[model samples]
Target chain A: MVRLRLHLVAGIVLAFAVRGPAFAADFTVPPVPTHYVTDNAGALSSATQTSVDAELKAYEKATGHQVIVWIGDTTGAVPLETWTGDTAHQWHVGRRGKDDGAILFLFMHDHKVRIEVGYGLEGSLTDADSSRIIRDDIVPRMKANDPNGAVSSGVAAMLTTITPSYAGVTPPPAAENVAPPIVSGAVISMFGLFGVFMLFIAFVIVMRIIGSIRYGYLVMRKGAPAAKKEMKGFAFWDSSGGGSSSSGGSDFSSSSDDDFSSGGGDFGGGGASGSW
Target chain B: MQQRSWIGPVAVIGIVVVIALFVGSAYNSLVTLGQAVDAQWGQVENVYQRRADLIPNLVATVKGAANFESSTYEAVAKARASVGQISPAVVQNAVNNPQDFAKYAAAQDQLGSALSRLLAVVENYPQLKATENFQTLQAQLEGTENRIAFERRKYNDVAQAFNTRRDTIPTVFFAGLFGSKFNEKPYFKAQAGAEQAPAVNFSP
Candidate 1:
């Protein structure tokens, strides 16, 4: 029985040990979205849209990861029902103001891309860089029907040109990771333990009462001399014979002396009463 | 023996975890806002460069047609000279030298006035209006002006966002650490009695 109990306790402990670490790991930082679109209508003419679609299809064919491109107005509004197909998502690409253009892109992996280039970017990004990504990376890949290569090349070019110093900005990856989520496991365990402790205390008290009653019945059935003596003491105590005798002059003095001695013994006596 | 209770510890851990998540998210938001401000600043620089590049071409075209208007040519020359002098490095040191911004503002204002004068001169030349090259240059200049205005507004918007994040409670605690202080850059206020992009009649 002891070995079985030990085995049970070990299993419970092992289960908790495994679960605790998993709970902690669950609070890890979620990956930042990488695919996004920008709002620059000038950047996305019908020609560009065709190129984007072709690039996405090629990407889907190569990587087996579908890419969807949805064009919306300045404010990100799209008809939900039109977002059909197994691999398609909506995005906003329009000019907010004279110089303010936004581009939002979404990758199949739920990653997002956001590019906002002011009118100022036109001259800063040489026609070479712009055309290379659109023409060399995105355009031809789409035309040749190689979407995967196009997206990979486009993403690489974007990553290369986007410097940390541009406008004193750093990408989200460089930012410090947020703190882990708090664990509910510890609190749940504490409550469970408290509940068990209360249940154990009540069980102990109930078991002790049942054991005493059973012992009393066993003594009466056996007709033991000790049982008879126990009955006489209870009978005398109930009838007031023992009380009257104890209250009498010399007996009362002896009883008081006994009472004082017993009270003193409780402080230093090694004797203990067992319940079960 | 009573079973050991685990609920108290579990509840304490849960509370701590929630608090950690909340604080973490707030810090991340502040950092993102800082990066966005930086991105917007890049856009501002791009537009500024575009305007700078167009200045020489516009000046050359105006100089060819406005030979008789010597004063207008001089104004344009002086304004261009002043613009060239106000470097990006000087603007970066705006806090240490507040006067630099004033000087920069004055140069830009002078340039605006010079361009206005040049336009007024072109109004007198019927032959210049009919030239295809001159008309194209004029259209490009107008587009460049619109671009400049757009970039300025964008810069201001980004600046406002950064400043707001810095000044607001909780986030303000770390704003100073990032060197994000309130920068009082000069805004492009409209010149007194200046008409909006005036209609230039190019048809002779």
Candidate 2:
């Protein structure tokens, strides 16, 4: 019975260890949906989706702001704020340096709505604005079973709040505070390790040269020592190998002129979340 | 042995060239990774400062509620003061100093809990919650909290990258050659008692 209990304990420990990656793998970050809106939960009508897409596209073209509306079933176990932040970042929903992007995430099943504003837009589209939009515009309509009205007006309020003339948030010619998301950051570090390994090899070579010179000196003086020359090559292996995995390249294949593509924006989690 | 006379000099020169190349590349890469950590640390500080800036306004707004619980807002004010009490020098050099980093993180976490407690207390006063000013502050506080979490996570990522490169084999051996240049940056551990929600005590 004790042996059985020990085996069960070991099994539970093993299960826990395996769970970390499994949980991460479950919520795969999907690519930015086309036309600036993806209603996977079928919440928005086709007509509303088309008009909203056109309005968002026009808004982006006029002001250089990218606003996307993504309606999904749920965010699963992840908190609403975290889910939207991660998704907005992965989608790169705004301009590269300006980071003037916003995403309105509506999880129908979870009954949560969040407006994830990019760093550049944080000044104009403040968290208070986002919260008010959700509280006044989105949550009411959502509670009334009108996802269409909720999304359209919520996005409208966001656009109005962030309009350059109205909000007085002019897109700065250059954003000094916002840093571009460091792509290939981990990959560069991997190269650093490889460089160190080369350095180690060079160190070994230097030692060998020193030894050969000393051996030659001994031979000239003592007229030949033992022929048994020991060559101990030190193998330095990384115990924490593969610890820094490179963030995989996000495929941006949809480059058609009319297609809505992310302009490589960064988010600092300046947004608000609400539930009906 | 007479024919091999040229070999020693050639081998020495060859090894010298290799050493020079490796040293140049290794040192450059270490510098690059270190700068990334420093830049990320700046971002973490920026977000924390943003949160701290919001606290005074938040406290002022909450103080308006008639007969509101003074203890909760006072606790938040005290926590914010402690967060500010941490010396700028220590904050600037925290990446290198694990103890300072821990203290900084603990103080910020204390402030975070205090703020959350204040928010929880606001639930009792519907009048305060309805007011546009109070609502705006609540939203800002929530957003700032999220930003703190986001920036902290990014800081940890860069710090981990630096630590991994500095401590991994081969790199580990060479990292010491540059004295104190590549110090292992400390990571922000998950907040203590984060999983448990703040316990709100109700007085009859």
TM-score of each: 0.38, 0.75
lDDT of 1 by residue, B1-204 (tens): 234477778889999999778666656776666566556555545545665676677667767874657777678777878788877887655422448756765676577678777877877887776666666566545444444444444444444454454444444444345452433223334354221233333112
DockQ of each: 0.01, 0.15
DockQ of 2: 0.15
> By TM-score, who's the top model here?
2
Clashing pairs in 2: none
lDDT of 2 by residue, B1-204 (tens): 899999999999999999889877877877899899899899989988988899888888888889899999899889989988999988988998889999999998998888888898889998888788887877887787888877776776677666666655445556766766777778777776442223222111
Model 2 chain B poorest ten-residue lDDT run: B195-204
User: Model 2, range A20-120, lDDT digits (tens) per residue?
Assistant: 21212235787666668888999999999988888887777667778889889888876666567777777778877778889998888988788899999
Evaluate model 1: give its lDDT: 0.42
Candidate 1 lDDT over residue span A1-276, tens digit each: 574455455444533432321211222221211223221322344555445445433332332222233323222221111111100111111111222111223222212122222232333332234333443455555445544454556544533443313221222232322324565777668779778789788877776565556448758786667665655545211433233322111222333311210000000000000000
Candidate 2: residue A29 lDDT (0-100)? 84
Say which docking band candidate 1 falls in.
Answer: incorrect
Evaluate model 2: give its lDDT: 0.75
Model 1, position A116, has a per-residue lDDT of 26
